[model samples]
Target chain A: MKLSKLAMVTVAAAMVGGTPALADLVFPSLSYRTGPYAAGGIPFADGYADYFTLLNERDGGINGVEARVLECETGYNTQKGVECYESTKGEGSLLYQPLSTGITYQLIPKATADGIPVHSMGYGRTSAANGKIFSHVFNYPGTYWDAASIIVNHILDENGGDVKGKKIALVYHNSAYGKEPIRTLEELAKKHGYELTLIPVDHPGQEQKSQWLQIRRERPDYVLMWGWGVMNQVAIKEAANIRFPMENFIGVWWSASENDVLPAGEGANGYKAVTFHGVGSDFPVFDDIKKHVVDTGKAAGAGDQIGTVLYNRGLYAAMLAAEAARTAQALHNTKDLTPAQMRDGMEALKIDAARLEELGLPGFGPEINVSCENHGGPGLGAIQQWNASDGTWTLINDFGPADRAVIDPLIMEDSLAFAKENNIPERCN
Target chain B: MSPDFLNFIETVLNGLMTGVMYSLVALGFVLIFKASGIFNFAQGVMALFAALTLVGLQTGQVPFAHLINAVLGTDVHHWGPGLPTVLAILVTMLVMIALAFLIEKVVLKHLVNQEPIILFMATIGLAYFLEGTGDLMWGADVKALDVGLPSGGSFWWEDVTRNWAPAGSDYFGMYIDTLDVSAAIIAVVLVVALTLFSQYTATGRALRAVADDHQAALSVGISLRSIWVIVWSIAGFVALVAGIMWGAKSGVQFSLSLIALKALPVLILGGFTSIPGAIVGGLIIGVGEKLAEAYVGPLVGGAVENWFAYMVALAFLLFRPQGLYGEKIIERI
Candidate 1:
């Protein structure tokens, strides 16, 4: 053998053999703590990190293995996100939770190629629900398609099971993340007779005067928004400016943060958004987090965003990842897990109501069960309304299923097209 | 009497109002550009930093609290009870003045007699540095700025205008944001004050002379360094006003810096050196973009206002390169 090749082989073997048995399970957080979207990203990054800290402090770790978070700031830019992914993926990274839809879309094929699982949870390409096509990408609990259907269902419920001839407008950000729900919404609009108006707001959406003005002129019965960052704040403010009923205004999960509504003050009262999880710091897990993670000064960022909406999401994502790690440990009969083993555990992961109660997050979110054929959990969501007076988002409805009749077909078509285009064979079969 | 006509008028009125908000930002750019030949790219970042300082001071937030906490392993966030809005604004003005002095000494002083592009590049660096420093000091969280500005629609005007629509027509009323109305009034006061300052005061005359010719102004016994500091301070104060209005409209956040994007087209169409042109150019772009978005946007996929302003600016550049009120660029060939 050549000297260089022999030396490389010896070094590789020794490194593999010398790898420590107690190495921490790595979770790379593609966080954007600086940028226009920092307001939304800060709380989320805090929550994610704090949850891992909680696991370390309160429970020793997930199944006796310490969980370490590798944070790389993306600045909410897609290129920066990809750069973060490349730089962090080599750190024995088990999974990725790219909070941005643009980043998630870019990471899907790349992560799949790298044998790592990406849990885009409630965001990203909705078709990833079809695990047959996208075995590595999981947007469990809910997808944008599910959120759209859930929103339509809530609207339908409000109108006594009918929204015939009613006008509904969608004020969406002009990007892939914003466009994900349009197809599902269109299908639902056809299934149930309703007029749909589409208004696209460009990125950063600092100015939406023209859009709100159009909404006023058209006077849609309900205005559904798919906005993020400052777009949400400006839209809510402009809606209030035009005297639009705050009750009729709804946003996607990304748009439901405190930053979005606090700017408009009392004017944002009664603003509703569809969420897959609970809001506020009422959960028992928060008490544990405060005691073990925050009070000890071992918290993530500031330690002030303990129970905010995005913070809770980050904590929930960590909990899911930790649970998946435990599941992987048990299935493989080993604590040291490979990224592929993590994918296996994620596929077989099941978090029932009892499991949630045991985890001290009772009634916080829908039960999730992952299988080979289903990467996205039972697509369920609830409606949350902002009460500007008390400064809290109250769950206005029970967690319910999305309109599967409309969503299933769309998912099938999109995923099938993606599978064909990428030459990816069905994996579940 | 036609509801469509009323809607058209309403669009124009709202357009004019939105235009005034754009002018608020553009005025700062014109102030700096007229006094010195540098197009201040940091004007938007200055507004963001000023608003952050105002919010931080009002809330009694300890400066660099996050960094301090991170470094010292402490949990300090606020220092004491919040300050009153007026007191906070006054304190914030002083901070902006100090920042102006520092910029003149540190950045502008060193870049004197350099190429205009070099000065512009310096402002870009200044913008990024200010944004990062603001984040490090106050943290990146969004904060609400009240300043007691009345927001939401003017109900009295809406009610009165509602009767103008046909009795049975769908046009409910003309919707105008009270905040936008207040911004227009403030913008007018600002422009008048600036005109009076430059046309009346000794320092203002020195500023105009410097804008006319930096070397000549220096030769005529005007202190160039003092003039730069004075103009930058005035620009900083203008940024504060713009910050208050925009911050009140939308919570003070990092996106406040992106308002510079909204001002770019206005600066292009309204000559780079004319304060009056900033206002007129803002109105033209605002009305034109709003009308296009309202009428032509629906036909095309909508969101045309994003680029419609730039398209108008491009057309203006094609016809009148110096802009409506910009001095004609004369060269001795």
Candidate 2:
């Protein structure tokens, strides 16, 4: 309590970026480089920063306008994140990538009021998929609901569509980020007739002997984890110790990273996690990144961390943001654009296979389309397995689309409520 | 053995091991409090700093890489090759001792005659300062500390125990990490060494004199300042051991500092000045919480590990406010 966390955040915010640019886009990266989650946060921050660096270094900046990359550390705390938003929102900041569900939920209202978009990207309020009511917030390319649906479907597919009396356990981090998939899982369980076991692990879940003991006792048929950071590593290690079938354990995209599984050693082999994009550094985009940024000695982080799974996800998020800016520039025919204009560009942004190829990232991720009604892009993801011996991941299943039947109505219901509460007109059409 | 009985035994064993880890941290607090009468809230952060320094030294990671890079416009990650494990540990010990001395001289010296609450608040500030300093020194990613400590399941123990267990019992013969076993052994050695050093050594007698009465110790020609420095250094050493155990267990990260909060309830149950009380209190809390999580946790949707220890401390305190082994206070004022 020496310095109020808000005060520290505000001071840290001013330290991020101060130079005003009239002909450039401003995107403040609300980053967490120091926290319990920093192990996961570092790569994402590095990748996000690196992508912007590459854009500026190689392409002479996005749409020929020098882009300003402001990195204000949030330490993964929600209130500090808001303080960061408050401190930096006035510096022509167009969008924010909070990378935390708690922060995203807190900023939804503020960003909506300020007319700047919040890009949560694959995480956050799943109902933010509805662009109409949540016009300023986007989790495009995927959402937590999409991940839940895809994971449940993958489980059903694995069990030959017959989990009539089977037990499925969700060992999730005990937070809004982890609890997000619960309702979706319950709905899927109702459909699949499977018994669901919810085991909540508190934040920074390092001690889980009792939870694992319970799992060993109950012997759930499948263990679906909604874990992040140290929790994922600990859970995987515990599961391996208890001799749980690693194949049957599926984690959300957050749980699938080298940092998460590598610590468990070979015991984590065959562990599976659903991901929305291709993993590894073998993609063509990495070559361009290496040639222009990393090899040119302009990389934002250690060269070794260039293309890890989380790193790639972060890079992809930055690309999407930059693409939105580019799209805005093309449509408006101007280099200087405001946050409002950027919002319009986000609404009309598209990144198809051709565009991915053009960006030197063919087959990197699924094609995504953003619109007024569908802020969440094509919600498709694949399952990847960990070859723990060799320390690499391989996609084990083809892309599976999220169940729109289950998710669309849920989004409609939640977003409509939000719109009503805020006295905003629905813009579904 | 019956499977239920075996499971109970396993839970107790696990709890005791966890309790030992907590006591390892609680011991540092006890040492400093007994000698200096300062409730050091930054003890956990001290452990974190020790571990970070250990890893940074081991890996030859340059201290203040980000700051150095920003200031000098150079992306320097390392100075050269890493040191051997033993050398790095020794260097880390030196760093911690120097830290203890520096803290005593700079921060602790200014507030010697202050009230315990004031000292406690000062320690909180120290905690924040040390935590921020640790992050700034080592850039905040969870670093793996490999002192060649054994990790993963101890299959030999499981294999041997499974031979005696009854057939068809789903008993996996108790899964315990080898790292935890190593830590428990190290902690036992550390406690024994501490006790012997205190009982049979000159510095130990001086520490005891300081603990007894500062003015009496000063009258007896024992430099209270030197004793304070010695005790803080010993506490720093204890924090290093605790840090290594935890950092190895769950990676060297920020949450390692939060483990101090867990040790707080232990200190409550153990009393501030009794080392033995720390051990006993930690075991009680660890066992109580684990068993509660196993039995009572399910009824309440689980996750009782968070508050069960504090609840135990609170319930224990209702009767004996001075704690189990605490010296009774005779107030005349």
Candidate 3:
């Protein structure tokens, strides 16, 4: 009987040991590397994956527990992205970066209910920057409204800070992502006394001749492009043909990329755009990539593309995800964490320059702090101009403070109304 | 009152230019409908694929040297100026021809004598298949198509005297986009050439003969198979030109297929079989919608342009069941 009891205990121990360890943290990467948006998606995915790999290699895991990133390709479709979220949410996913506005909209309600964080970064419902109703959704740096204000300000400054009686046309992609900035522009136009003409370009933005022809006839003083993929290049070429001063044109960040301008070559010279983050080889994280990721033979892109616009965006996104996990680990005694712990960790996280420097990203812009009331902590960015001759982008202005005074109250008022409508629970403050 | 009337006239004129572009695509539909009763839904995708291929060749994504070396067993590392453009166009044309041939051989050959509706559904399947294949081949980056077309306007309209006078007002003046005007001119030329060929040429006549009575034409010793190939080839060439013009205007992306859908209302407005009707219908829809959006759209809270073309076509359909130039039916059943 003693021998039998001992054998039974051994069997029970073996079964317990064989059972898979519950993952400390689960992060789902909603990637789109194979679809219409793949040109932008592929590099972003590569950078995201490399950063996670770097953390694993250098940190020996976040706080002694390894970090796991589960990737699901969504092909940039919202339905597919939501399906991926449902399939992976059960795995204790700490956060989701859908990288798509449509997907973010669909996931917002579910994410709030499930208490999982959704980090949209530069894209998604701009109104969700309100930390109240969209408590789960975080659009850090700035929202589309912030981007529009900056672009309009830059144009005003270029035209001597008086845009009254000027005609400004917006040739935008017809999607939620493109339409996000229109309301802000209209408000700004009303305040500033400028004429705003809205032209909606259907998806994939091929066939803009008629639109450009209208520009030629109407001769708007300034043209703001909210385009993506080939739409950017097409607009540039069309503007160039019509002899529209390239200097008078501004593109949203998504519309401004090396791929967009490089194809146009000399034609896209003097085009300007607003950037939420620093560009090119200026950031300190690039050095870390060279030493840790590239030197280790794990970097996923060509060596030259390490600090390109989209690549840096992907790097920044990964940094945010890793920092959230690190913050979570700091709170919990054990490094191994659950999604709830990560959520709590993200809410309390503070990422300043000193923190960035210590983390080997000294050149990364000012710190971002997340709280119950402010999901977009660093609502600041500078404008960059593309010089076709040098094949480079240069910072033209520092982050101007004028936009904030206008944007803050709007964010608060909108967030409050949204909270009321969505039945969002009041914050503890 | 004068300024208001001038603005009204300007908006109408602007709408006409828009209509011309819509007509170009619609004409492709009419051409295919004339030769084979099937509405080629893949026409828009064909335009996108052709344009992307042209741009890709110019940029040397997959070097022309490599393509030529692989094909001709040459060691050439560099090619001559504009050679890539020419070769890419040739290759695209050949691909389109092969596509037309394959479409006939694989799909249409099986559905011979089937209802027009069935053939239309098949073309829709072909549309999805072509879109996927085009994406696979070109990797879905929007590409700028440079078909050696000029895009700027001339100094004649910009002169001070021309600018000041009411008749010479920038609004009233013929300050046409050289590229769009070229596209319009090319479209007109193609339509004329097609019309003449159909009337004067033997093979064209044989194709028309086949269109008129397939069984009777077959009995008269004209091979339906050969005639089908000829008509599809002509349609394929016309599609290539349409693709080039539209692709140059917009970057060649998958969304070009939707522009092909704009041809549907054009087909409905113009009789499905009337070439002239397609042109007229396309022009009407294009110009009409833009004018509506510019003036009437503000009254309706904007976005009226999106549904205006369909509404106009629907209204026409309700009044004239046979279409503007469609054949009058004489039912035997």
Candidate 4:
């Protein structure tokens, strides 16, 4: 009993001293390394971990304040993610990136109230991109709504600048993340005089013969996929079997990955997807990773996988977390910072080409500047196509702004209406 | 007189195809139950495993040569130089037979006299084990299993005009998926093959006698252990066929086990011991629940289609306690 009491006292002492002694920013990573979604989740999580490790090792940490990442496996469940958030939120958490849309939705209110920021890059309630209703929630780069608009624009561009009377089918996973894009597509259909059909595939998405059989019967002009995990590969293969032109099919960012395409081989060729980030080993950031991290043996498992698509996404997320920390430290004028201070830092953070080059990524992508009223400022995305012969994804187009003259007012109006209904205060811009 | 009616009819037709797919899975559940008293809850996982194995073999994930070396102790990976689809299937059937033998010896043999429910729970454990094993062996990616089935459809006058019918007509014209139609035909063939083997073969007769009275069959010089092995082997084959149809339809993934769950309602609706009843029960439940969901789902929420099948079967149980074709029970005090 005396020993137990001593242990408890020691732990308490460690907690008190550890915060300032570490002198590093903490970003709690709620990962799902084991689940039905693990196949997709593992790569993303690995990338996230390695990038932070790289920063600490190669670049001497973010502004000399070492970045510390604590990974807690949540298995992609909302309840577990919430538990992870609560447990870790106390230990100087800079921000929370739940990855799961359901958990993101649940945390938005709590995080907003607590003054903690939630960075749901590319996957969350697309509506939460509305800075007025969802002040603390930041879904940057682009939302699902923006993705849908860009995809529609790409389709029309491919079909000679008209989509009137064309039929498009959305084969999506039956989840909040998958369904988020439907509102945008429905609105676009009404505006452009096209027909939209939605077909929802149940979770884990292994069985789609029936869904595709419906596709075969209906014979839509194009198919838009909003699937994740195993569903993406299945959809591609099914489309191939039914002789649907791969070029006519477009997948959201999550649906296009090496894991999704490699399993299908030749069958997945010519399948184009709207990608937000460029993928390949050509970037200078990847070169530094190979030399400083992988070669020096400081890298994690699969070090050879330095520049895969999901790996780069992970790097981007880590970069964002580190940048937020740097901003927080600078703003607060102290290395030892709180979650609230870190959130403010995130809002004030700006990542430009100079910062990217300093980190060894020469012009990796665009500069992002976050503000009070603008979460996803100047939303831009690229397009990539799968090349089965070379076994790689090739960039087909550079980042183009989503036809915002069409999407902006719609986003603003809907955001205002949502804020009024939910009793959320507008951002102090 | 509204587009809502047209949409409802279209949904019903879609539901019927879904029901047909569920019935194919149910057919496998019925097959095992007819021969053995144990309800095989792992049948859906068995289908998933089989389909994943097939895709794995074709994609060189599980090299044919490696399988041949493991089983037959021969280097035959390059043998026959890319076997035709038909030959690959035949080879897979042989592999399934070996797998059945292994399963009967390793798993079913240990729990021979356990209660049916206990055996059912064992199969559920087996289901989880197999799903994990299959995913680990074949890298948890979705693979399209195109078993050369046609996927085209045609619209008849009834199909075209059924949406124009009165609100309460309950008539949604048939628009069958060619895949479903083919699956139904294959299921019938499987049932007939199983029936002929059980009725005419000597081993089959011995198995049936064991099913009737275990002690009497033992006295009459029949081997219960061998009979159990044979029964399990047949069930495994049935699971493979079910897997091919299902895998071809959806893509082979671990989620195929949920499709196996649909068989429970089929078992409840049909007598657990009756083969014909299992098939008919599957069809009735499939068509009835799907029709209900299509016609009735929008009134509540859209997810009524998920639970409506089980609900209809539950209601049926209240009226007919022994199930639709269960044997009449005569209890003696």
Cα lDDT, all candidates:
0.91, 0.86, 0.75, 0.73
lDDT of 3 by residue, B114-137 (tens): 998999899889877877776555
| CA-based DockQ, model 3 | 0.25
Considering chain A alone, what is the TM-score of candidate 3? 0.90
The local lDDT score (0 to 100) that residue B263 gets in candidate 2 is 89
Q: Could you say which candidate leads in DockQ? A: 1
Ranking by DockQ: 1, 2, 3, 4
Worst 10 residues of 3 chain A by lDDT: A296-305
Poorly placed runs, candidate 1 (over 4 Å): A1-20
For model 3, residues A68-161, the per-residue Cα lDDT tens digits are 7788989889899999999999987888999888899899899988988898987887767767567678888777888889899888887798
Q: What are the RMSD figures for all models against the true structure?
A: 3.9, 7.0, 4.9, 7.3
Once model 3 is optimally superposed onto the true structure by TM-score, how far is the C-alpha of residue B320 displaced, in angstroms? 2.2
Pairs in steric clash, model 2: none
Flag regions of model 2 displaced more than 4 Å.
A1-22, A295-297, A302-304, A419-424, B65-81, B156-172, B330-333
In candidate 3, which residue ranges exceed 4 Å CA deviation? A1-26, A33-38, A53-75, A156-179, A186-220, A228-234, A259-265, A281-308, A355-364, A400-402, B1-14, B63-82, B113-118, B160-174, B329-333
Error of 3 at B25 (Å): 2.2
- For model 2, residues B198-316, the per-residue Cα lDDT tens digits are 89999898898899888999998998777878888898899999999888776777788877887889988998888889989988988888899888888998888878989989987
True contacts kept of 2: 0.41
